[model samples]
Target chain A: MVDEHADPTVGELSEGAILRSILDRLGASNALVGPGDDAAVIAAADGRVVATVDTLVHGPDFRLAWTSAYDLGYKAAAVNLADVAAMGATPTALLVALAMPDSTRLSFVTGIADGLRAACRELAPGCRVEGGDLTVSDTLTVAVTALGALAGRTPVLRSGARPGDVVAVAGELGRAARGLRVLFERFTDAAHLPVPVDESVLAPAERDDLAAQLRPAPPVALGPVACDEGATAMMDVSDGLLLDASRMAAASGVCIALETAALGDDPRSALTGGEDHALLATFPHDRPLPAGFRRIGRVRAQGPDPVLVDGARYEGRAGWDPYRDWDARTG
Target chain B: MVDEHADPTVGELSEGAILRSILDRLGASNALVGPGDDAAVIAAADGRVVATVDTLVHGPDFRLAWTSAYDLGYKAAAVNLADVAAMGATPTALLVALAMPDSTRLSFVTGIADGLRAACRELAPGCRVEGGDLTVSDTLTVAVTALGALAGRTPVLRSGARPGDVVAVAGELGRAARGLRVLFERFTDAAHLPVPVDESVLAPAERDDLAAQLRPAPPVALGPVACDEGATAMMDVSDGLLLDASRMAAASGVCIALETAALGDDPRSALTGGEDHALLATFPHDRPLPAGFRRIGRVRAQGPDPVLVDGARYEGRAGWDPYRDWDARTG
Candidate 1:
């Protein structure tokens, strides 16, 4: 069904041709039987497979004008890997389902493959794309399902937190959210859309922030380390710190007390900012925090609220709610 | 952010409310760790998982005018389960990622969950919905990734066919395509769109045929039976017999010869129709065909063409091509 004579730029090419290109880029090293068969087979060495899925829609989750296809692919892979890592498992393989408009560029599709492969190579060495389905749609969307091997270790759950546990975090806290703000300010009213920006023209910090927003380098390795070191409870922070922390506290039936002093300067940014894809976990109070992790708070007996900001209630808007209508300025 | 008192009928409820409702319906029977966690874990009894993913888009895959969310969900599960069965594996679990417009009715969301659970209960007793994600989008899309257990049996592959193997099929054909024709004709010009039609109003044959198109009942058990009976190669005939047979022939470096008389009445529909999702397989010439299977052809040495009907080349439009564009009549 692949159209060999069709133009790639206008997406007159068939789904088969694009699928083959993506599969060729992936090679499926970890897949026992890769794409082209009825179904792909993968070994679940420990007798179980940890699975998670996330979807990124064009309008709400990303903007084509603000980010390239390569960066979008990188972020998609990072999001799924972070979830698997939060499960205390070794990432194994991914199945991607992509939906796009008929006019989508072939280069954009291949660029997504490149970014997904490179992220898997750098973050999870053995991970690869196993199988996927490509279809036509009005808006471009990417949905990824990631599988992981537990290696016979116990999966850390959010219900395991105790009153005396110490709350900690790995990776940056507010960089990605801050980066989004910068990009929104800079490109809010641009006449020529989706133009390439020269990084040399922007401040060093601004450029770095934009990179963080576009392609988040999640702390995939730190999750297993936290589990091995005996993390009592764990989760990845995609929503703001306070919002996610409240979730943990509610699930575990404990109160999370944040220490503003322990968090970096500008506590509001660290407390309410999100999309960093960082790991937040709790451990026994006496256990020494591992490298790449910093103590941020403590667990306490159930209080009036699930979370306390430096011994007082925080009265501010929390973080991203996917169902809310899209707002250009706030998004 | 789940809202407690928002009206579901008016689309004022939050993402959390709809998600919880769906999870409640799923109940997660096969999940070691189900939804509400970072990820879900499912047992791979034979140390491996047979995985496949497929996406259903709004305009291209289905029209909301002709089918309900329940039928959509049931078809989604059937499509993935058939692929796993084609691999000679037992269906185990599914991870669903759904993207829909914010104005989508809450009943539509929960109805999909009910349909998924019902299909799993009936077709695959032990299989269940493990985890899923729900996000906002302009169009409603469902992507399902199914996992299966091999149960220590070798997977049946399309590449295993050889000269002298007898090709056979174990399920009905042409009915789904015929059913699609009936539906398209009946609902083509309806003014009040997307209204539910009472099956009692239609002729029994038409109702039954429409059911086949909306929800296919694949020969799930026959796949494993064929494998045990030493079938050389197998695949689900999703994209018409001729098209899929050509694929198997090309993969195995052989020619598939078919006898039109062997196919049931209306050979054209049986040979060129798609979406029936019946199992097509080849067994060694000496082995006895399974109880439900009927011999339709033989594998032969490679000829000028991959597939031949009654000793002559047959030509026609093969099957579905997702990127071909949205044509309601053709679909």
Candidate 2:
């Protein structure tokens, strides 16, 4: 058991002292260059390195009352690893930077690390928490950078879509969006709910959707598979399908015609709801669709602007804009 | 020329809108992958990646009275790039995460970018600012991650020192310490001043000493050269030389004997002053010394602890401890 007195406030310990204590606890295995160095160097077997970063701020991005430090760690790592996966890379290491009030509990920090390790094991095996910096601040904020390897395959970029290319997606969509809706809109309803409650109370779909939003399971290997199978333009569906599709179209200088009617049940939810983390890629029409992916659209000779529902323009608000007052809209 | 308007507060523009405007002004070279994507991809050649991250908060790290947003950006970039250089790597890219009050002026944000670009050019030419996230918070904070390449040379580690190794250092020391002293202390007497001033007012040595502290010149090339010349153990002088030397001793399980008499004038300052960003390395006595480096000490087998002049343990405070009472000691 750990000593209770060891949990000194961050302000009470020097940066070097705190780092020494943490390093002592984390025995050597995954670490190549541990803390106290300028930058931790981890092993990158394949020639190419994959990387991504994310920052979470208090209140705007997350509320301390609603989420624990552990959840924050898990979510931050998850999001960045998902990005590496989107690039057809396998995560190998992470660098974390955290700022919080001096009075924060050591237990809270340990819990955060636990969550980070758990997510690392689930999403990218062999990934390790290599290094990080901790500082005292007025509010809690976390920034994470994840690095990975491309495993000798060409990277999947978002500017390769051409006319006569088919668009497809891997992994489930709309669940995370539904989860956010349930959590924010129906908080009171979920407050009194017990674990494994009656499915009818929340509806099976709604419960699944809420769970998905809270903890998204990104298709970590689909990106590499898509690239190997000759994906042209590729991206992750993060800010809703329509907005992302438009980005691919703009980058590739071509038109994308998404078949909304063929999207199958809850198409609108998948179209504009965000946080799906599904791989969306375009392939030449002559190439067969890879296993486990569904064809949903096609590239067109028409210029630039993306079209949906049989060549009609999508005039609705495409997705959530954090800086704007959000109001639901549909085309 | 850019448009000059009464700067709109960040609150006035949506996050997407702010990003779009910034991207428009920066043009294409600023990005490999810009904002609005899952994660920004950057070009990392030489088959190895070097990364470092740091976070700066409003109160603990800086005060708005002493630092402008532009200075904040420059300082933040400087610190991270220093880490990359310390690793014997050439910095290539950066990702910034900023959190500020909604009322921050757009002009301030642009100024911050200009500072970042300016510093990048000085430290690592062609270093691109690839991607980042911006959000609203109560107090301002900036987190930056810098990436670099090792150019195929082995990284200098801190565990290779042997009894016969010669300790050498590149670049000046104690300048930042004196600068901090001048900033915090108001001593009027010429002799009592931490930094030297005009020759008519003070000794020549003091003026040069204080100047070193204000603007540190890290010897970036020294790291790679040391590694190439087979440096036994190496590290950047972040903490005072004594404290860092003790660390190298502990890591290598050997004692270090320093000839303070050999260190160019003001040996005490060289021993305890910090933020030099100088590369300190150990090499076999027979090996040719690298240019721009001076021999300062030697690795020894006799002492139990890191020893200074006359084979005595260094008792004077040699480094900054964030948790310690700086006022009580220095005052």
**CA error at residue B329 for candidate 1, angstroms:** 11
Q: Tens digit of lDDT per residue, candidate 1, span B1-331?
A: 5353443631466667778888888864667887788899999978999988988888777778777889899988988888999999999899999998877778788878888887787778788889888887887899999999989999999999999999999887888887877766665555423444557778998887888888878888788888899989999998788989999999999999999989978788889888888999999999889998999999999989999999889987776666664543444
For residue B72, give model 2's deviation from the true position in Å: 2.4
DockQ, all candidates in order = 0.72, 0.42
lDDT of 2 by residue, A203-240 (tens): 77787886576566677767778878989878878778
CAPRI verdict on model 1? medium
Where does candidate 1 clash, by residue pair?
none
Q: After superposition, how far is residue A58 of candidate 2 from its true place, in Å?
A: 2.0
TM-scores, one per candidate: 0.94, 0.84
TM-score of 1: 0.94
Q: List native contact recovery per candidate, as a fraction of 1.
A: 0.85, 0.50
